[model samples]
Target: MESTAGRLTRKTAIISGAGSGIGAATAELFAREGASVVVTDKDGSSAASTAERIREEGGVAEPFTADVSDEAAVIELVAFTAQRFGGIDIVQNYASNRSLVPFDVAIAEADLSVWVQQLSVDLLGCVLTAKHALPHMVRAGSGSIVNVSSLGAWLSFESRPAYTTSKAAVIGLSKSLATEYGKQGIRCNVIAPGHIVSAGTENMYSDEQTEVMLDHVSAPRLGRPDDVALAALFLASPESSFINGQVIVVDGGMSAYAPMVPSFRRLAEAT
Candidate 1:
């Protein structure tokens, strides 16, 4: 086993969607914590970049190209991780896909393909990853699975019916995994992130848009990829051994202060 000076010493983790954004951040964070990381992404080059960076930083890591939505690919991914690291210990199922559809449209007007596409990658992908990885974790007597969900799962602020529905299902699936597999020493939890500035979303945050978002966000600054990464590390490490089947919202207090007073109003009223 490869041990380091950090919390995850001697542990191995499989992170899906590790090509960029929160996935990449989590992979790098896990490595720094003394974990041997298997960085899997649909984009082979992106996955390799993340793994190479980890190695450069004196961590154990490797990249694999796998589509979480595909059962065969998921199975192969789990097998490869177990073979390389001796057994599976952690899995962060974070891969997701969504179609660009205006939120104003009703679900009835939404295209069926969008629903299938989003569900396949976001919901079913998590299931397949757990299904294949659990047996190994079960045999090993302990494991942690952190499924990345979105704040949209619980809030109505966003559109994309398929996207919201799929994300919500993730929380439900994670709870089931935790309840059913708790006896085996395997834990599953959900991480719900809001307004994270990732590679996939940076361009969408215009100055005006950011100002509006800040009005809703109680924190001084917007959320970051590391915020979510650190939360995942906690759930994946021994520090959270007794924590399972819970939803950790990393939104900088956005959800907590929902229906907040408008920023303009706060400014006009002053303190």
Candidate 2:
């Protein structure tokens, strides 16, 4: 089997949301795997730091800052990558924000502000990035897109209506793009990640909740950023040329198992 590190030598990649979390991890990994990486983030400083880290490791990388939801910024980002790296071979759409508002409350009390905010970052951002990058990839006759969605797209979560809806829409959009561009030699795939440990989860999960979450997963721990990054690498590489229009779940088997039930018998015995 060919190692993934050598798989991307002489290729070029563009990754959004490359400041932190999964995006940052994937940017570094892709660079190590022999790609000239373009790391773009809304945060210029963080994106620069990520690019510097890659350079320090003797890898080729450049950083750009942009709000991916903006059309002009998206166009500029695509142009910058193509100009700098010659042509883009891989694109990882990972820019998004999260919400914790309950649906009923949002419907009854809040305006559509919350909904639009989530959609702007999670749904429209992907579309804008993909749209701008498509023409370049089409001209080259080859490209791969790895969209980062959430497991909440499939499983229901309370107080997260906006996030859920946007993620679900992302998968749908990815499939449509794949179908439309398959004959054009472009592949689009979505990855729905579950319970990944990040800033949001660190604040959301209580100690007890964390323990319960681990019990629900086949893996003994919560999902890590690198876990998803590695998956993104596979999807972005030519190694997955035959794989397209698919949504891969990376939730440590949480989606495959039934909810964990606390033992009432044990409770009674303890009492």
By TM-score, who's the top model here? 1
lDDT (C-alpha) at residue 113 in model 2:
77
Off by over 4 Å in 1: 1-5, 98-105, 258-260, 263-271
For candidate 1, lDDT tens digit of each residue in 119-149? 8899999999999999999999999999999
The sequence of per-residue lDDT tens digits that candidate 2 reaches over residues 124-197 is 99899889899988999999998888889979776577788899999999999999999999999999999888
lDDT of 1: 0.89
TM-score of each: 0.93, 0.91
lDDT of each: 0.89, 0.85
Worst ten-residue run, lDDT, model 2?
98-107
Which candidate leads the pack in lDDT? Answer: 1
Kindly give the stretch of ten consecutive residues in candidate 1 with the minimal lDDT sum: 97-106
Give candidate 1's TM-score: 0.93
